[model samples]
Target: MSPTLLVMLIMMAVPVAMVFVYSTLSNVVMERDPEFVGIENYLTLFGDEIFRKALGQTAIFTVTSVTLHLLIGLGFAMMLNSGLLPRLAAALFRVIYILPWVFTASIVVILWQLLLNPNGVINYLLEAASLIDSKVEWFSNPSLALGTVIFINVWAGYPFIMISLLAGLQGIPGDLYEAAEIDGAGWRARFFNITIPQLFPILLAVAMLDFIWNLQQFPIIWLATGGGPLNATETIATFTYNLAFSKHEFAMASASGVVLFVVSAIVALFYVRHQKARD
Candidate 1:
């Protein structure tokens, strides 16, 4: 425990401490020395409309993406375990499903950018099929940007949730399912009574984990949209990163980082408590 604690300190504590201190200073693009600014940085963030919008968009992205991930993951996991396909077929499909996850976020962004382009394969097919009369701007349209990014995220993310749920499904006691079968339980009954109940903990855990990961998602949106088309898909991560690297507002970026930390910490604590209760 002591060694593990030391590792955590090295990994999380030092950087977090640095950020906290940095957040207190007035560090801007042309400043030679950072001046202590107290709580002004945090206060400025709250009053900033762009920051507020980013928060709202972040909320929408995180909620929508995580919900889709869970639903799609559960569906795929059930299908994989249903024995509809032979073992070889199921195994092959499982590999196929996980292929998106094997690719890096940069790869995901570039491939999707091409697919979602106005004259790309998707729109080309749609137009040829007479689905739409015109090209649809995916990232360029403010109304569609966030949703487009969210869809891409879901496409790349569902495989992980599916794999996790599948692993959890394998741990359920077969005897319980057999007993349910003997009791004349239908598929629906067995799923609700046996499968869901046994899988609840894993589902809850993965939901929380997904929420946390989605909260910090940057590359998928950044590489693809860069929070573009009037900042429609702007998120906390992109906001903070742009401040630090592009705008060189170190203090404000650090302040945003601290806010993110607090929110994540609250969620993590809730998850830990929930896990303990389940245990």
Candidate 2:
């Protein structure tokens, strides 16, 4: 095997095995000795209200962010593919759209922090448009923080989806669309019938992968809100970090990590089966 593949395999496997072992015992980082306590961490996790909230938040975050990624990405891809602009212009927009994605996640979070401040340009634009009478607290308000994180995630992630769908769109034979037009089909009919059907397989694959990524998204949400304002924006990834490093609940953190691994594995298994059926 290639060195790169060997490295990747080791990287993926070792941490999971270590974390699973740590979950069944108390290993407070390097601060203390390891204690082998069976399933005590799981019991603590089950009774922890914060963990429950984080789990629910993760589900909401993953589903909403992934859905928006698909819809907005599809919209941009279709717009670019609509023949409304020249190839050069479309290509330029693609480059511009992916600019946010080119930066490290921490940098992207910091940039958005600047933009989403109460007195920031986003609120200024809103006020100029008379959309609101006052500044909106993007990260400080508990009610709005989770949705704000999801919105930022969508902004950072949609370009990848857009480019992927664009590739799939360009792969479609023009004759199929031309034939549909010749049969007197409206654009809506063509999109619903031809475009959707042809893209369904790719759509499922992208959706599954995107869901997995969003489920464990860490830096963006953490840097933006630090799972703050009463842990409103907390997801599993942030929850694990806060537990392991911040609070020094290493055993519980390892259990949370193990749970994430199991949940992700289950989702990936389903995705693999669905993809196989498509083939």
Q: Give the best candidate by lDDT.
A: 1
For candidate 2, what's the RMSD?
1.9
- Candidate 2 local lDDT, residue 208: 90
**Clash totals for all candidate models:** 0, 0
The lDDT per prediction is 0.92, 0.90
TM-score of candidate 2 versus the correct structure, residues matched by position = 0.93
TM-score for each of the candidates: 0.93, 0.93
The runs of at least 3 residues in candidate 1 whose Cα sits more than 4 Å from the true structure, single-residue gaps closed, are: 1-8, 28-30
lDDT of 1 by residue, 1-279 (tens): 899999988898898998999898898445888888999999999898989999999999999999999999999888898867999999998998888898899999899989989999999999999998999998898999999999999999999899999999989988998999999999899999999999999999999989999999999999878987798999999999999999989999999999888888888998999899988
In model 2, the worst 10-residue window by lDDT is 26-35
lDDT string for model 2 (90-128, tens) is 889888877767888898888888998899999999999
Q: Please state the error at residue 134 of candidate 1 in Å.
A: 0.9
